[model samples]
Target: MFEFLLNEEQRKLRDEVRELVAWVPRQLILDMDQDKVTFPKEFLAEAGRRNLMGCRYPRKWGGRGLDWVSTCMVMEEVGVLGYIFACVFGVGAELVCDAIIQHGNDEQKERYVKPLLAGEIFAAECLTEPRGGSDFFGTTSVAEDQGDHFLLNGQKRFIVGAEGADYFLVYARTDPDPKADPRQALTCFIVNRGPGVEVAYLYGLMGCRGGGAGRLVFKDVKVPKANVVGSVGGAYKVFNTMMIPERLGTAAMTIGAAQPAVDVATGYSTRRKAFGQPINQFQGVSFQVAQAVTLLDASRAMIYATARAVDAGEDQNHTRRLISQTKKFVTESCQQAAHHAMQVMGGIGYTNVFPVERIVRDLRLASIWTGTNEVMSMIVAHEWYRAYHQAKTSAPRDFEADALEAESGEKIYE
Candidate 1:
């Protein structure tokens, strides 16, 4: 509906991504859902071969050097397939690559970033642990410096692509001081899966399966000093940078997943009969479809605006809030849309005979991962109030003055 915001090149990129998505076979999606495939290496390799993995990275690193909007476009199109596909695609293309492109030296880029985008290998991020998932600063994994190398010993949980990942982007506490600031206490590394690295156990998930989601155990793994990303103690900045793509990408892909569910429901209503009339002819059924479509369009529009704001490099604090809003709102809205779609289809939707059930399971995780929606709301509320005090600087718009009792007893305390 708001396609005008996209440029010619961006539209072209969208079409290219659509083609790639269309090329996917039905068996792959079914197998991945059934947990028959650990990782869709062949699919990712094909995407890399087509140069569709990292649309935002520079062309020098096998990416097309596109903008965020373009990248989100890729994410959304790929998302139509499922969450696992877009995730494995982005873990290497953006999440892992962003750290290297922004912090890792050229040598590290050549060794890790280039091949990952090209689909020659796969990469995964290790930030969550047995102790916590969202508590980034409270990391317990420690890497002891050993002059020539660092012995990294820790376990990360719920690492997607862990089973098939050629290497991992791991974060561990490097400082010995227990009181040290979390922002200054840790370091990031590109840890390859070798001798001491183990894919401890794969999870049995209800949805978003197949991409080798599992636990990782790193025991006395010798990581060369050269594998450090950014500075030794500046991983906080790297972690912050990685979150932008994480939330924004998740929000964008969710739009793709939800749209198809709505389509299936709407289409089914037209053919399915009730009392000699099409089911959609009933207000109850049509209204649900309307609400689902509205939620989807709204989600897409928010993503478009937020992606543009990010590309323009708006105020860092404001951009952060907007990204959080995008993630929280879009994920929730899309999940609701899928739920509505399921409702519209009645008995059929609840069964495997239709794809809506599968999509519902995949969309269920959107609000929980990439920072929970609860966490997102906290950021939004905090940012809004922090910016609230700035309103006093302007004397013209005295909203309180418009009230019947202008003074209002000065709010009793202020």
Candidate 2:
């Protein structure tokens, strides 16, 4: 029934990732969660050694050269490990690599992508400033050109890999023209961490921790002109293009975090007794289980469909619309599924004894990060409205009404 979704090679790849995740001990996961420390670099190095770091990039750059669907599959498995693991891997593999592959020059690619995919170095995207939350263009970071180099000075907060990243794919206001288009005013650069760059402060998160969430302060950091990605005034394009992989990857990870929540809830419900019977025997609990399962399956389907559309090189705007919708729907659904799982498992679900509580905390960030669910809704609404208006002009009433009693125009108000 599902033959059309993933082929033999993809299935094998999924199994391979599952095996890789199996090597991650539950104790280590729990320890990391409790300590709120950095993800074990050794674990990431092992993933690189196994050639599982960049599944979508070309094999020449140390990746598997796989498709978006394959990358999503790997993301889903890593997601099951929890938010920290997903965030750590994602900083290098999805966020940074996509930008470098798209905008970096050949030398830039060799300097960053190869070592990143090989796990020799870590990377992070420095986008969110101290003031700007979801507003990418409102960034206050400035990169002043100094003949051969740019002196960067800014503070970026909520950077996932700030504490450990060897370098950052940083964005700054290069034009500094107040009247200029905000989209054209920004620029991207590859900034190495050195004397002028510092991990300023670490954030204590509610759920998603252990991925080195911190603030990065660039104090007159000198980045060479050769490090400019794409062009001085073309970062908007790079940022927008990177959104595709970012949103799709987040959606896939949502599925991963949600599936295990459903599994744990289901197992517990079937065994735990309530009112002289198993909790699963109760309609209230059973219905919640059914809903959780439905959400998981539906989320998986939407994410893969979006991934396939990306792989097929569908229309950029149309694919973006689908990507936004997938990220919004899947992340929200995963959050809801985790909530339902917690309810089904009763009080114990709220404790660390079960993974459901942690899933709840982890999935909350999925909607907030990558862009808020509200932002996703805005994109979906805008695209849908555009298509709605165009359909009226292009395909207006081409067919006879099937159920209407009168002409469509006649039925409408003046």
Candidate 3:
């Protein structure tokens, strides 16, 4: 049996973030999107002053030195507000600042991580290409070394914050050894967006329209030799490390998005009268709300548990498996919850006037991006099978008294 819980600090952080973000009117998000806005530098600078931009990294690198769980809570609150503030600070700080802290040299860290933490600059993680998304190892982006610098030539698609990004953590193939492992062939470079680098906006997205995502075309864009992150051909490891946090953060985002829909539906059902009674008094609608709440709570538990494991420096393989399962479960559950929410809201949910419609569209992208739900399911199945096989020979043991008590209380079984 399992339980979903949040500590005092996490609760406080969530409250604070929610209070701060509440000041940002929803119409501002629509306005920003309509204006084709670049990053909101002023708002980000305010966030920087509050230390929100550096929530997960070490204090030495201008971060808050918090654990991954705290970071997840912060991300969830931001996601609840919408993608505008979250996208600006989340991608800039988590993906890029953390990458530099982990792999950048002293000079690189000082140049990129510090300023980014101060919200003086924006960064983008460029992994997806026009030719590949999940198949990042098959990237056709190439970077050629020329003594003092590397010339990058390729096109990246679906790059978040590309239009406003001052720096890009670009992944490219530096070695073309056909016999070498595909994953090992890929390398990463921190290239400034300058001459020969073109950024094109990806307008009219189905959802997450507040976030700036676009295509980047690099035509022999020159990068200094010192700008390489980690080892020359070590992108696989970097990618793996980066994804752990990314998936965990995504889970939090889904929970944030879904919870609102669930709340709205619950409120509507309890008040809207049908057949001379509140709609929620009906079994069908009540059951749907119950199921949605259960799934959301369960998903939050898995996500927090996985984040805690990573922060504790537990086994990487186990953590990755947990992360994959959490992402798959949460994203799928969110979509289902959104659908039920719409169903409960009836005709009102179908209109743009209600937020449930937008939430449904937003949650759809969660399943598709950051590795598809199909891919996550395959990974989860593989890991479960491996673990089962490895432990199958052991004898079974009796459950503890607490386990029995919890199980008998109708809690979900592990």
Candidate 4:
């Protein structure tokens, strides 16, 4: 249907989001960083009006039915706006909306995803307890089946969009199996913030401060039996399934966040004079710009490539391997780009007058959120080992046989 990597329609969608970035006042972005903004409901409503909320979802559910790569493109553009906005949009559409579309039953889909994609209400994913960080399967939350309803208990902290979300996608231990793997011991539920659901604390964050990240305590909260997502003990599957969008989306947005700082630094270097010439004339400053831009471009390429793989319904292992690579490599690379951009600008970059300071604060979270870079490294190494062993055992091929034979004396494994 299309010749280039992005089709005509996808290009237009990117334009739409780019137009949004132009329309939104820069002051709003600054205000969010200062903790003056609570939520971006107005922006969310405008995004829904433009039909940009759920690019990869079905049209019947108020989505455009676009591909995952298109969603990545849009997120990258949205990321240009600010990290909080990009994160709010990504969590609602990619994380929560996609989960409901895949695992929610007919009624649940009609109830949640439809309105969710329309921006009629907000949603939050309740994972990550105080004790467990990346160990999702070790969740301390428990949901007991109470006849027609489930009594949910326990608390989730550091949840983004917790203060404004109307619904929650929660995971809890339904039937704990001590001897069984923790992966299969939990269940997923959709809960509403009603009686017994409390917003315990709002964290004073160093960056990405808006959207009210907080602690949610569920004390004997009642959720209808129909609210369960997927099977009773199928949360592991749902979590694994959602990781693609979660990590990939985060990576794409980080690309956007990384670029603005580079642009700022480059522009500053061109204008800021030192020794009767522009600072950009110096290799010291220019190379930083070059490195930053290279990282940004590389991060973008990997994110969209992995996103296309996701759209193609690639093998789960392969998709996760690429996604982990993108998350780890791209995030760290972007974080470095941000730092370089700041260094290029010197003192002004460290101040709020320029955006590099804010970008440095924001980009730091990219490696920490969705999953830590350490976790991503573990996944990449594990997947690499699996593929390496498989190729050696199942589909062995010696591409360097001549070189190895010619250098036989160097082979000392025996």
- lDDT per residue for candidate 3 within 53-86, as digits (tens), equals 7677777778777788888788777777654456
Candidate 4 lDDT over 74-143, as tens digits, reads 8888988778889998888889887888888889888988887887888999898999779897788998
User: Which residue pairs clash within candidate 4?
Assistant: none
- Clash pairs, candidate 2, are none
lDDT of each: 0.91, 0.86, 0.79, 0.86
Instruction: Give me the candidate number with maximum lDDT.
Output: 1
Model 4: runs farther than 4 Å from truth?
A: 1-4, 393-414
* Candidate 4 overall lDDT versus native: 0.86
Q: Judge candidate 2 against the unseen true structure and give its global Cα lDDT, from 0 to 1.
A: 0.86
Better of 3 and 4 by TM-score: 4
Candidate 4 minimal-lDDT segment of 10 residues: 395-404
Provide backbone clash counts, one per model. 0, 0, 0, 0
TM-score of each: 0.98, 0.95, 0.90, 0.95
